[model samples]
Target: MSTLNFRRNTNNFVSGSYDKLIIIWQVYSNNQWYCQQKLNGHSNWILCLLLNNNDDLIISESEDNTIKFWIKQNQWVCQQTITYHTGIVFSLSLNDQQSKVISFSDDYQILLDRKWNVIQKIKVDKYGLRLCFINDNQFIFQSFCQEQMQIYEMDNKTKQYRRMNEITIKCGSNFDHYSFPQQYVKSKCLLVNKNGKSVNLMRKKENGDFIIEKSIEFDDQRIYGQLGQDREYLITWDNKSKEIQIRKCKER
Candidate 1:
């Protein structure tokens, strides 16, 4: 599986794969998972997947240079396909209010409204592996192989997003992959980012500044993990260790 998103309330999850298919899985009370549906639309590998707050909408990015929106009605159906990006769509992030979505590609960063209409497209100098919204009006984009992550904020006058600042991050190697997308936990005000060979944990302050809380380095660039929902632990697996490791969060 290339990307996966879980609906916390329903115990159902969706996964996208390298085979160019999206599978929805239903979890039973006995802890067994069964295939609920298989969605086919992308012509290439599915890169990223995001489920909306209500779990009724799914946005998927693919190597086919397209973003597909699947709506749940009778069954999951493709309601829209966005082909604005000329290159592979790398990442997709929905805002906190679910009023907008931001997508990063090899060519441009596109912003869309709730109705999935393109509102703005900004040409990026370097294609980032991950981009995510910190809040409703602010977001952070990590440039490929760059040591700094750019922050964009919405302008009060124009209502357009512009690059406001940057936060220094660790990029130990140029070697990169598709997994370990940037994730922000709102309840804890934390951001987990994987850049090159290190997973950097940052704390987002109320003033919109990010402070690097921790940086975990691995021998290999292939590091994959995620933060626990309770914000108490982080579980990760690396190619070098070849074992699943769990790290507890230290309170400051």
Candidate 2:
């Protein structure tokens, strides 16, 4: 419930709290992140969200079992909904083209078209908890209570996605997890939060394998990381003072 976001390629950010609210933050002429607007809609906790560059649109899925689409014109407001879960919609992910999406809830992994309509659904033994599109045709998925990490690819012939590969991930514990922006995931390689006190940088190999490249340590309590839009910086929570901190990534 302590999740937040920093937009890329622009001086804006977003955050969702346990209170079921979304706040948009922007850096105005003063070069400071300031609250620009607050969006209210979900009746329960906001579990995950996504926003693109212009920050004109946002998609957030909540524990209330619905995905709300928001648009910004005169104000930020919800315009559409994707609801199918009986419990918490743990994670949501979209491809770069915004033409395909996936959501995980309970024991199901559902795929949707651009309009938020369910196109496909799969039942799984382990709950899908976190997701990020590795590319337009490939995605990375993690389980809620297991160390398994998997990559899925869309089969052009069938127009369906299937598991391509898998690996056992190293989490702080079986429960430590978080989601990062997919745009940054493709560029910076990977976003990592090491039990909240440190963040590790990971880069993908030419073969599509990932390796830890660097580590950024923090004295604050365990916090997650979100890559800056440029992929040259990262933002994390300063748990001690309830503030946000930014760190620059050294050039490769």
Candidate 3:
């Protein structure tokens, strides 16, 4: 799987593949996941996908620089193509209302828009390290260098984005865009950023600032770690699948 995502209010999820197909899976009464729909259109590996608020639209980006919009009528079909991207698109992120979006591409530009119409664009040194909206008017942006993670807010005066604050991730040059995974603790307004060897928990303050609350390290540097949905457990595992373990988050 290249990328996968779940839709809220339903036991359904979508998985993207290097084989250039997007499969929608649903859990039945038997509690077994079964493929319900296979969407095919993108001619290259799918990098990311986003399901909108109503779950009626799915936007997918590909390495071929193609962004396809899939909508469910009586059946799934390609609704339209987002034709402006000229480079390999790496990530697709929607705003809080699912009305606006921002994307990172190999073209080294951050493009912002609503309903496929380009609203504003910001040039950067690199693309697709980790770009996400922290709220409706604010987002976090990182470059390919990954030296710093900057927070950007949409300025009301200019009606465009402006850098508000920054945090030094300082992961160094060896790690690339996909080196870290971030999980949001919505209830606590915290974001868990997990690198190979360390996990950093960032709390978003009322003033639109993010501060690191804690940083924990693990012995096995390449371990994959995830915090539980209810913030009760922290799960970790190395390459050895059998060694996977779960422990209370408080014990970390």
lDDT of 3: 0.74
lDDT minimum window of 10 residues, candidate 2: 175-184
Q: What is the C-alpha RMSD of each candidate to the true structure, in Å?
A: 1.4, 3.9, 3.2
Which of 1 and 3 is the better model by TM-score? 1
Please report how far candidate 2 places residue 149 from its true position, in Å: 1.1
True-vs-predicted CA distance for residue 158, candidate 3, Å: 1.9
**On lDDT, who's better, 1 or 2?**
1
Count the clashes in each prediction: 0, 3, 0
State TM-scores per candidate.
0.95, 0.77, 0.83
Give candidate 1's whole-model lDDT.
0.87
The sequence of per-residue lDDT tens digits that candidate 1 reaches over residues 1-252 is 877778866888999999999999998989999999999999999989989888899999999999999999999999999888888888888989987889888785655555788988877777788889988888889888789999998899998899999889998988777688888999889999989998999998887789999999888888878887677999888988899999998878
Whichever of 1 and 3 has more lDDT, that candidate is: 1
Q: Stretches of candidate 1 above 4 Å error?
A: 108-110
Query: Among these predicted structures, which one has the highest TM-score?
Result: 1
Quick one: best lDDT, which candidate? 1
Model 3 C-alpha lDDT per residue in residues 1-252, reported as the tens digit of each score: 867777865789998989999999999999999999899898998878888878888989889987788898987899788767789987677887888878878887788878778899888755554577777888887655454677888899998998777786534234443423455665678777654345666788887667777766555445555576468776766543437777665522
Q: lDDT of each prediction vs. the true structure? A: 0.87, 0.67, 0.74
